[model samples]
Target: MARVERDPTGDVCPAFEQPEFQAVRDSMKPNPPGEPRSEEEVLRMLRDSWKAGHDKRVEDWNMQVQRDREERERLEREQEQQDEEQAERPEGEGQKIEEDNGKKTKKVYFDENIAVGDTITDRPASYTLNKLKLIEYIELFYFTPDGCRKAQKESRSTASTETWGITQMEGEVVGLQPISALKLSKFVKPDTELSWEEVMLGRHAMIQEMMKLGDEVWPVKVVEAFNTMYAALDAHPMRRQEHGSEATVKYQAHVRREWYDRQARKQGFNIGVINETLLRSMRDEIIDKKKTESLREVSVQGFQKNLYSFRLPNPYPSILSE
Candidate 1:
């Protein structure tokens, strides 16, 4: 073994005293305690230095790895929160959400049209499943539980069951739905009560909804049914009587005069059924007159603006001809 090297003070070994040293920092060779270090001791000192630095390096690397792991976890949590918000927001009216490949997309919604030949199901009550889709909808001026009950019973084919009954406002109905579900459409908890305005307003809101459901051409009979019911409700003895005959009221007044004519005939009042042929002729004449007047107004406006160089020919000469 090499002899131990001491500090200048002589009582202490340099390795145990003062600051720890690297090969480059070992400048204070002192008198070395009066002997040079042996090859065995020199090699041992070098190995000891290598072990100390190696241990320190391992500890530093472990601390850096722990910090990296924490950063990654924080980023993952933030990303999850962002994804949740995008998945829920409905965006806009008439807009639909579609998702694909962990992403979301929004598109405008349009109603799907149902053709006359297409098959449909109408289940107003348990027994009355109009598989034929023949009967459209019904309306009644009722708010009483028994009013609803008796109206439905006289009209209903069966008893109310757990899964079946009625809950919608019994207003005049044209077509029950254009394929939309109504909270006003189905039976609900018996305890739920509704106000007069709520009942009538719900029906009106649903009628507007049906128009948006791709129903461009409403069936004639359905239109007539709506006209009949709206008139009945409007003229009800309990209606807000102070309402004046405003243009709005006049416009909605039952245009189908046949309703009263038919009712009168059924009651044995002597009046002929308006001939369908003559009715068609009269309707055509009214429509033709309106068109002519509309065209003349447009021409007058165009002339005033100097946009019309001459009068345009009538597009429907055959209809205008005697």
Candidate 2:
């Protein structure tokens, strides 16, 4: 191979030259320079070219095949890498596991009266709510530490970044779903000197109202938490009173009176001694009604009239008349 300084170009393989394949034509004379050859002559020239460049053509074909194989291998490696990356990523957590029929569900110590030191657990098991007293309901406090810590962390972030956070606490001011004990007694009205019997009536009225209403709708979490708390409360040692029979007797009397009156009303009669205080209250109510009526009287005229009257201004003679 050689290059001419006058015309710089890549080396053309001499094996592809016509003279190099003259042996294929057995030294046959070529068509005259610039003369158009017939189809047969063109075919003969192509055949001769192929015969001379057989090695060169094979080398070129092999190179192209090698390049294609490398490209395919590179693509396969890339695909494998992508698949490995996908496999490495983890899935989301806290998905509910389907319960097994043969396995007994685990129960945790659920106390609805959530204390500060109590460890709240989000367990991987089903639970129940147990109750002991009619007024004292149990509640669970599972969201305390874990939920509150997360909430606190969120407060830290949001308080630093957002406008609402400016007014909100950067740290938690309270634990998750903290318990607020109710002083609502069925036998005593809250913040009032109402008697236990009066409280019992109010409670009865409330119960009646509750019975008249449809089922309460609570969120799934709320229901579960309540159930857990009740279960613990029911199992607690203090669930049943050890003493106070006198108080119990008094309460039972009130309940029995209510039951008796209810049954008696159904039979078109009245039973049990009505409370003296209650009777006094009814009498006072009647007296108030009579007093209100006594103060009332029929009006002869609903309103005194100030009828609109227009008077012609003082009748005066004009200067022109004078």
Candidate 3:
């Protein structure tokens, strides 16, 4: 079956219709807090947003890239100087110097990788396992009655889950996320009513439902569950209005620090003990989970971008010759 690419000329921003360009385009767009934009408004906003700050953002990005390059070069020079100094030291002292130099080199490489959003994969097996466990813990905590606190904090209640759908003069922004277990079990049974006391614990309910469906679809369902939950949280009015789009961006330093502090308190670990290395590893796990969630949707923008990379050969060569 041929997949039709959505024409960006309709209502939405052209950049938005193309998922591949979204990461870059997001910063280009101006998003006023709590203001829901309809498709019609998106095109207008896109133009205004680009005209307003696109050049400034490009300049800023170039400056930052230059700074990172300089920093990396500086570290390389320091490592080279240390390497030269090691030769003059005693054998045992020289060995220690070599180890210290190795550590510095590794730090430089790791930091650069993180800055560029590259995946970190050099952790020990135990560390990887612990990272998985932590992610599972955070997700499990979500399905509990305690998870309803997120909704309550935003002033939402069971009485009107429908109102979670935010509307403005422009139109609907994001629709309400169903209160179903894993956002998939409504087909099997009615969606669980949203109430702190009577809410179905998603972890338990998911387990029960998974048994009926068997192992084939379990992975997809789990990823879908996480995605649904995350989308709902991100769409919350408080997150939208106050925090704006960057509130929970996984790569941001402040967001990482916040998550570390929150998780340390919840998991009964000392904040000092959970260092940046471990936090980065855990974030990698989360990134992997998000990747799983996104695999189901094919990006039309990718195909379109490829098509535009080079011109196609003319099918009617005789007409061209004429």
Top candidate when judged by TM-score against the true structure: 1
What is the alpha-carbon RMSD of candidate 2 to the true structure?
32.3
Clashes of each: 2, 6, 0
Displacement of the residue 218 alpha carbon in candidate 1, Å: 75
**Per-residue lDDT of model 2, residues 1-322, tens digit only:** 2222232123344442356565644434456576555545755666666556765555566666677799999999999997786666665321222235446889888788977666433321011010111212211111223322443454445444433111111234422211111111122222123333343333333333223332442234433433333233234343244322223223333433454355446532222233335434444554576667655532212222222343456567585468
Candidate 2, residue 204: Cα displacement in angstroms equals 82
Tens-place lDDT digits, model 3, residues 1-322: 2222332223432454467755555554555786555554655666677655655555556666677799999999999998788767777997786689788453433454445446422211221122233332223223343443443333333335532332121225433433421121111211222221222254343344344444553345544543444444344443334222233333223332354466567642222222445335545666576677666344666676887897888999999999
* Cα RMSD, each candidate: 28.9, 32.3, 36.0
Task: Quote the lDDT for 249 in model 1.
Answer: 30
Off by over 4 Å in 3: 1-48, 96-322
Candidate 1 lDDT: 0.41
TM-score of every candidate: 0.20, 0.17, 0.19
Model 3 TM-score is: 0.19
Clashing residue pairs found in predicted model 3: none
Which scores better on TM-score, 1 or 2? 1
Rate residue 26 of model 2 by lDDT: 46
Top lDDT model: 3
- Which has the higher lDDT value, candidate number 2 or candidate number 3? 3
Model 2 bad stretches (over 4 Å): 1-27, 30-48, 92-322
